[model samples]
Target: MDKDQQNRITYTVYCINAFAERYRLTAKQAFAYLDRFGGMAFLEDCYEAEHQLSIIDAVNDLTQVCRNQGGKL
Candidate 1:
């Protein structure tokens, strides 16, 4: 990959790790929530650009799904 692509990848990883840390989430929980929403790559999109509430929205959506499935969120 080019230098720009490498930098972008590194930045994305940093941003996602920051978000997970901010929420006090384990990497496992963070990935699970993303996977549950069929959005395992959701972080990459937001990391590439500025995001408003999409990540939170996704977590909320995943929460609802878990609740409906009789599982704890």
Candidate 2:
């Protein structure tokens, strides 16, 4: 699901697990992608991966962006 579709933290959690399952990505791998690249990069990578961008990816990506922009996550 996309960020707008993630209605609750539990849903976010579910999306994370679903994303991991669908892509064979470890939680760490998924998180690292976001941490190193941020939202645009994450979305781009997802598109490159196969057109599946989930909310968990955005959470991590946005976190990375915040950190990069001095928000400290």
Candidate 3:
């Protein structure tokens, strides 16, 4: 992959790990959550908004939406 793509991949992985650790979830589960919500686009948004948005905040938002939609974590 190109440098930019590689960077994004690395960033996403970091975010996934952060999410898993913070939520006591497995990496797979964290990835599933992101996929269920909005996939890489969601991660990208989080990365872009890092200055204004915390990862936990983003995950919380996703969790709330999932719960509202009758989806279990």
Candidate 4:
């Protein structure tokens, strides 16, 4: 993959791990929750802005986005 693609993937994985930790979920669970609740799409669609924020802030955004989509945590 190109550098930009690789960077996006790396950032995505990092966010997934961070999101998992923040919500006390395993990575697989985190991915499933995100996939179900639209957090994954939020991360992809907003990657430019989201990547500029701290990982904590990014995960907070993920949580809110997921919660808004009916996620419990």
Question: TM-score of every model?
Answer: 0.44, 0.34, 0.62, 0.96
Tens-place lDDT digits, model 1, residues 1-73: 9986887666545544554565688767655654665434544554444334455554554455445655444
* lDDT at position 55, candidate 2: 57
Rank order by lDDT, top first?
4, 3, 1, 2
Best TM-score goes to which candidate? 4
Model 2 residue 32 lDDT? Answer: 57
In angstroms, give how far residue 22 of model 1 lies from its true place: 1.6
Off by over 4 Å in 2: 1-7, 34-73
Model 4 alpha-carbon drift over 4 Å, by segment? none
Candidate ordering by TM-score (highest first): 4, 3, 1, 2
The TM-score of candidate 2 is: 0.34
lDDT of residue 69 for candidate 2: 56
- Give the backbone clash total of model 2: 0
How well is each residue in 1-73 modelled by candidate 2, as lDDT tens digits? 8654444434445544554555577866645544454633544444434234455665555555646755432
Residue-wise C-alpha lDDT for candidate 3, range 24-47, written one tens digit per residue? 999999888767766445557656
Candidate 4 local lDDT, residue 64: 95
Model 3 pairs in collision: none
